[model samples]
Target chain A: MSTGVKHFIAFAALAIILIALPKVFVSGSAHTMMSLMGIMIIFALSYNILLGQTGLLSFGHAVYYGLAGFCVAHAMNYIAREKIGVPLPFIPLIGAFAGLFFGALFGLISTRRAGTVFSMISLGIGELVASSALILRSFFGGEEGIPTNRTKFPPFFGYKFGPQIEVYYLIAFWCFVCIALMYALTRTPFGRMCNAVRDNPERAEFVGYSTQRVRFIAFVFSAIFAGVAGALATINFELMNSQSLGAGQSGLVLLMTYVGGVGHFIGPIIGGVIITFLQISLSDITKAWMLYFGLMFILVVMFSPGGVAGWLALHQPLLKGGRIFRLIPAYALALVPMAMLAAGLIMTIELAHRMLVDAQSDGSVMKLAGWTVDAAKAQPWMLAIGLLVCGALGLKLAWPKVREAFAAQSAEVAQ
Target chain B: MTPALSLQDVRKNFGPTEIIRGLTLDVMPRERHAIIGPNGAGKSTTFHLISGRIKPSSGSIRLNGAEITGMAPYEINRRGLSRSFQVTNIFPRLSVFENVRCGVLWSLGYRYSFWRFVDKLRDANEKAHAIVEEIGLGARRHAPAGILTYAEQRALEIGVTIAGGADVVMLDEPTAGMSKAETEQAVALIRKISEGRTLVMVEHDMSVVFGLADRISVLVYGQIIASDTPQAIRQNKAVREAYLGEEAH
Candidate 1:
């Protein structure tokens, strides 16, 4: 099929999924989760504009996200109080404008230089905003943060956004629009020059491009999108807090972008979904879920520096050559040892935590895999260690077969 | 005829050390001038000074009778001056076509244009394609510049240098790491691209210098010892002892 047709079909499929998702899930929590995911997808993509596309290593992107969120929240509150008759869904535009305003302000100073200096400036700004958010209680609302009622706004088309599902559709619409626009920006000459500046600033200058201008433009655009995401957050949660502007929030977006693979356009989307899923689902099961996230990020960096998208992209040639199915047996063979390794590692970690920290309160016995095991006992320790060693050995033994199979398939495809 | 580029009393200091000391030279319009020098003679430094990569301590540099001493590199580039680095400085990750297209973007008046898709710009694509074919990398146009062979990368470097359609082109050791056959090919390519354009080159290869240069300047210890035809430079006693002494063997 032609590429244009493929793109049309892909977009059509995406629209269908977006429209049908809340219907299929049909729960308030599901709507909430999907809305959060949509907001995160926008946030991640915006971060990618600087990190992935422009090669600017910003440590304080959440400044834009948080600042915009706060601005939108305040606007919403004012609108409701005055009965200004603005529709609920159009509030993100206010966030976009606020983001653009601050982006232009900060971007002018930060984009004067690229690399370490720019990163340092962004960090300083982020810290300044986050700290100021507390002292300026009227604007940031102190520890409580500013709250707004989305349903208070006059209904548009006779539909009040009181229901979570309504909010989901609103967020989803903005999400699709933002994604399409960001993707289009990447295809433009300015976007190409951003990559050039990122690769080699000297070469870019010789080619008649002002590296700082390219960076500043990209930074502003990124901030605008991030602000939109922040606005979505305000509408969804009805509150905008100082936590949104913190370094931790910035780091979370960075984690998502890196894990998704900044090299490809769709990488951040994958990262957003996976990281959001992990954040939501994993947090419910364990309080140490963040540790898992750090571990996943490290693994991605070491094994697949291009992130998940990059890892998947490696199979493109095989797929094109009609040889992707050839690696299935090898992948299946590797899965058993991989699962064993994960189980053994998790067991060791949980048991060790129980033995070291929780031992003072809860004596000896730890519940794992529905089995009660004595944490202080030598027998259980030996069992855990044996499983760990066995899993490691099994993986070591199985890896060569997977490698050999891959090599064979590659060689065949080459022929 | 007016000089295309003129440097008067050009001197560059890096902290305590002076690199280009009291260097003055001029090249007439459309002249292919070669600057030959020994190691550390500041040949590349001179290029940097002209291209605005580094500022000279005290000097007046002019291009087409316009002062450009303290201008930024892009500003100098905008005033019809383009250069390539001694090291292969093509964007390593971008495709060869994209690399050349980047060079042509500013000259084509597409400065910071985020509204137009670059692929749809027929003039830019055609110009970039012409450059790729001229550099003899037509088959490898789609390859990432990093993956090209050293000689091919050198060709790409030249392609990028001339892609802007600048009237004055400065190439720093464009054939630095090439084999003899590759150097011949590069010299031919350089000769083709530098037609009706002012070419300022810093080269070590005597054959390329004597073969392609309309006039040759011999630089030694940050000073031009001789500025004359290749024949006169070859005959000058100061040029012989200062630079061409080893090459004479």
Candidate 2:
């Protein structure tokens, strides 16, 4: 197929999936979670424009995400109070405005110095805005945040947005547009310049570009998309607050992008989906879920370092060459012991949590990955350590077998 | 011709030390000029001043009769002057074709544009591909530039330098670390690109310099001791004693 046709098919497939997902997973919780996933996907992708595309490490991207969200929240309130006939869907425009204004405003200072300096400036700005969010009650609504009613605005085409389904579609529409636009940007001349600045800023200047100008433009574009994502968040939760602009939120997007793989366009998409799922679902399964999240992040950074998508990218050429079956032996040798290692690690963490964190409040007895185990006893601890040792030993021995399987394919792997 | 590039009384100092002390030179339009000097004689520093990499402590540097003193590098480049570094400088992660294309983008009036796709710009793609083919890297158009062989990367650096259609080009030690064959190939490429434009280069390779330069300027201790044709410079006593040493004898 022609590339145009292929792109059409891909985007259409994405749209169909987004629409059909609600049909298959028919639950109120699923809709809530899916809506959240859409917002985060945009946020994380925008963060990549700075971190991945422009070689900028921003510790304060949530500044734009939260600032735009507040603008959107307050705009919603204004529209309702004035009965301005503006529908809820268009409120993101205000967020977009806020992003453009503030992105340019703050970008001048932040993009003046790249590398570690840019990161430090961004951190300072994030703190400044977040602190202001608490003290400026009239504007930020203090800690409770500015809560607005989505139904208060006029309906669009007879849909009141009162039901969760209508709100979900609204978010899905914005999500689709933001993603399409962001993807389009990566192919433009400006996008190439961003990459140029990232690869060699000094060379970029000699080629008739101001490195600062390229970085500043990239920062603004990133902020615009981030603003769109923030506006979507306001609609999803019906409340925008100080926590929206917190350091924790900024760190979450960073985790998503890094874990997704900064090298690929869809890396953050994979990051957004996986991280959002874990953020929501992991809490119910274990009290030490945060520990698991930290462990997974640390492992991704150290071993794979490419994030989940980058790991999958390694298998792409093999699949294309019809040699995927050759990997089965290696994969099995790796996965079997890796699973044992994960189980042992989790068991140990859970036992310690019961002793130090949960013993006084909850209990000494708890379920581990759906199995009944008493943290108070010695039997589980001994089993945990035994499995951990054996798992470590088996994985160590599996390395050569893993290397042997891919050794023949090394020619195709070097970029 | 008002000289394609004119540097009059340019000087640079860092703290207590003076690098380019009261330097002056003129490269005429379409004339190939080469600057030769010892290691710390401030040859690269002169290129830096002309290309706007650094401000002259005091001097008027002009390109095409227009004063470019204190202008930003991009502004100077926009006015049709370009340079290649002493070291191989390229966007390592970008494809070889993309690196060349980036050099041509601003000159082609697509400065900082985002609305249109780069692939769809037929004029730019054709120019970039032709230049890549000219540099003998057409086969590696899709390869990332970082992985190219050293000689190939040097050729690419030259391609990027000339791709902007600049009227005046400066190159610092373009053949600094090349084998005999590579140096000959680079000389031929440099000759082809400098046709119908002004070429200024700093070189340590004697054969390449005498072969390419219409006029050679010898710099010693941050000052030009000799500016003349190849034969005139070779026979000058001051030039031989200061830089040429026994090579000229």
Candidate 3:
């Protein structure tokens, strides 16, 4: 197939998946989750524009997202009170413009120096806005935050967006458009220059390109997209607050981008969906969900610095040469030990937490996995230690087979 | 005829230590000039000052009779003067072809264009491919520049320097780490690319300097000891005592 046709097919597949998502899940909560995922995907990609493509490390990207959200929320309220004729779907454009305004404003100062200085400046700006949001009651509404009704806007084609499903479709539309534009930007001469600037600013200057200008442009675009994500979020939750612009929000997007892999275009999207899913599902079942997230991030940083996308990309040569089947048995053999290790570790942590922290209310007994185990007894501790030791031994014995199989398959592919 | 580059009493001081002290030289248009010196004699420092990577503590530097003193490197480059580094400074993550294409971008009037796809720019692509072939890295054009052999990286550096179509091209130690055959190939490549363009080079290799330079300047202790034709430079007493010595023979 030609490149054009292939791209068309891929786009069609993506559209189908996005449009069919809410229908397949078919619940109010599912619609809410999908909408959140769409917003996060856009946010992560915008963050990637700086971190991955441009090699900038920003600690306060949520400033744009939250600022844009607040701006759109104010616009929505003003439109409703004065009966402004602007429709609801076009509100993100307001956010985009606001984002661009602040982006250019902040970028002018921060982009003068890159690397550590740039990161520190962004952190300072983020904190400035976040703290100011508390005192600026008229705009930020203090602790209560500003809330607006999306349905107050004039109807678009007789649709007031009264349902969550309609809002999901709106976010999905913006998400796809922003993703397509960001991807197209990467193919342009400007995008190539951004890469050149990122890799070596000194050489980039000798090549007759201003490194600061390239970074400023990328920073602005990244902020604009992040603002769009914030706009969609404002419409979904019907509120904009200080938490939206906080450090925790910035950290969440960074976690998604790095864990997904910063090297590839699709990495942020994968990260956005996975992190959002885990955040929603895991938070319901366990109070230690954040601990799991931190562990996952550390593992990704240590073993797979490229993140999940990088790990998936590593298998491409094997798949191309049809040598993937040769390593299947080794992978399957390794899976059991890995599962055992994870279970043993989780069990130990939960049991220890129960014993030390919850000791007063629960007596010495802990209810876990439909079994009542006495924390004072030695049997459970011995069982946990036994599981941990056996899992480690199994992993030690099985790891070499996986490595040898992988090396042999790689050699075969190389030949 | 106007000189391609002119530096007059150009002195650069880092803190209190003067690196280029009152160094004055003139490079004629379309001539290959070489600056040769011992280690720590500030040959690379001179290149940095001329290229606008660093400013002179005091003095005037001009290109094509236009004052470019204290200008940014990109502004100097926009005025049609380009230089390669002594250390290999090509973008390591970019492919060899991409590295050359980056050099041609500003010259082709594609400054900061975010709308048009680069692959669709036929002229840029053609020029970049021609440069890759000229540098003898056509087969390895798709490989990342970081993984290229040392000689190949040096060749890519020269290719990048000349790709911008600058009127004045400066190279720092183009054959610093090459073997005899590799140095011969590099000299040929440099000579071919510098045709109709004024070339300035800092070289440690005597053979390369003697074979390629039209005129030679001997720099020692941050000052030019002698500036003359290659044969005259080979016979100058001060040049012999300061730099050439037995190597000139």
Candidate 4:
């Protein structure tokens, strides 16, 4: 299929999945989860606008996302208190405008020097705002944060979204619209010039497009989308605070997007969903979840530099025909060790945490496999050995088949 | 006859160091002109002045009687002038076809095209294909420009300059590193390519200069010592002493 057609089909599939999610799951937790995915999708894709399309790395993108969330919350409170009166849905637009204003303000200065300088300026801005989130309590609501309600809107679909499912549709709709606009922007003439500027600024200048102008336009557009995400998040959660605009949030967005893939529009989408899932699931299972997350990010950066989109693109042909079934054995062999190692590591971490934090009497602690051991005397060597043995066996069994699959895929595409 | 391009009392200096000192030359329309000099002789600098890559320190540059000394490169390009660089400046990541298409698009009055899709523009595509074929790169039209051989890259550069359809075309060392057959092919390409236009070049190869340029200018230490028809240049004592003296052996 043509590239455009393929992209359209992929977009359609995504929309269908998002629309049917609440019904298929029929759970409040699933709705909240989907809403979180919607918010991250915006953040990651906006970040991709600078990093992937313009060849710029920004370290303070969370400032816009976080600030926009704060702006939306303020707007929501104003509406609720009759300081301003309108539907809650229109408030995200206010968030987008806030994002655009700040993005342009920062972009004007930051885009003056592209590579490392831009990254540094963004980092500085992120730190500055995160620290000030406490000072601006009147507007930012201090540490407690300000709360607003989606129920403020007149009931449109016979539901006020007091439930998370109603909010999921709203967030999902906005996410789809923003992603589509961002995608369309990439295909525009200005978008092509963004690529040109990314590749060679001098050449783009000679061709009569100012490099700064292109970069500035892209920067502002990215910020607006990020802000929209912040606004959507506020409506879903019914509160906003400094943490919404914090540097950590910015770093998380970057990690998710890069892990998903930058250049591909769909990459950010996949990344947002997966990272959100892991953030919630992993944290519950272990205190060292963040450490594992960092290691996983680094591994992805090193091994699959192109991220998940690139990895999936590489596997596209193999997944198309009778050869699809051939992947099962490889997948199974890969999954066995991966599952074992993950479970073992989580078990080890949780058991350690329980022993230390909730110590048992008689100086003995309960273990994962129904055994009790002296908490102070428990050795980590056995857990390490088990994880390593399983991991090594998994790698050994997976490599040859994985290599064969890649080689076959390469050969098939070359023709 | 009126000159197509003229540089009168052109002197380019950076801070205190003088580069092109009081240089004056004239090329009539349709003349194949060559400037030859040793390194730091300001031959490339003179091209930079004419192409508007750099403004002249003193004096004026005129193309068909209108002064155009300090105009921007694109403005100079728009006003019936175009040039290739000493180093190949083609966009490496783009396909050979896309590179030429960009050249054709700007020349065909479609620059900064936001509304027109590059692939859907038939006229630009056809013209780009024609130029690619002209430059002997039709077979590799889809290949990235960076992956092409050095000789092919130079040929592609020439194609880009001419693709603009400018009145005066300047090529800097068009066949600098090509083999014997490739240089011969380059000379033929230059001759065929510069048919109706006023062609200006800076060449080190005496053989190529003798075979191609109708008028030759010899420069020594940033000053043109001889400007004459090829026959006169070949016989001038100062020209021979300044340039051909070392090559006589």
Worst 10 residues of 1 chain A by lDDT: A285-294
For model 4, state the Cα shift of residue A374 in Å.
Answer: 7.0
Give the lDDT of residue A137 in candidate 4.
82
* DockQ of all models, two decimals each: 0.90, 0.92, 0.91, 0.31
Interface Cα root-mean-square deviation for all models: 0.5, 0.5, 0.5, 3.0
TM-score of structure candidate 2:
0.97
In candidate 4, what are the lDDT values of residues A223-342, reduced to their tens digit?
999999989988988888788788778889989999999867789888999999999877875566787778789989998988999888867777764465566677777777777776
Give the per-residue lDDT of model 4 (tens digit) for B106-203.
Answer: 66776554555666667877888998999899999999888999998999888877876888989898889789999999999999989999999999
Deviation in angstroms for A171 in model 1?
0.7
Residue-pair clashes per candidate, as listed?
A: 0, 0, 0, 2
Compose the digit string of candidate 1's lDDT tens values, residues B1-249: 669999999999999999989999999999999999999999999999999999999989999999999899999999999999898998999999999999999999999999888888999999999999999999999999999999999999989999999999999998898889999999999999999999999998889999999999888888888899998988888888877788768
In order, the first chain's TM-score in every candidate is 0.96, 0.96, 0.95, 0.89
Q: How displaced is residue B70 in candidate 4, in Å?
A: 7.0
TM-score of each predicted structure versus truth: 0.97, 0.97, 0.97, 0.83
What stretches of model 2 exceed 4 Å from their correct place?
A410-415, B246-249
lDDT of all predictions, in order shown? 0.92, 0.91, 0.93, 0.82
Q: What is the lDDT of residue A8 in candidate 3?
A: 85
Candidate 1 vs candidate 4, DockQ winner: 1
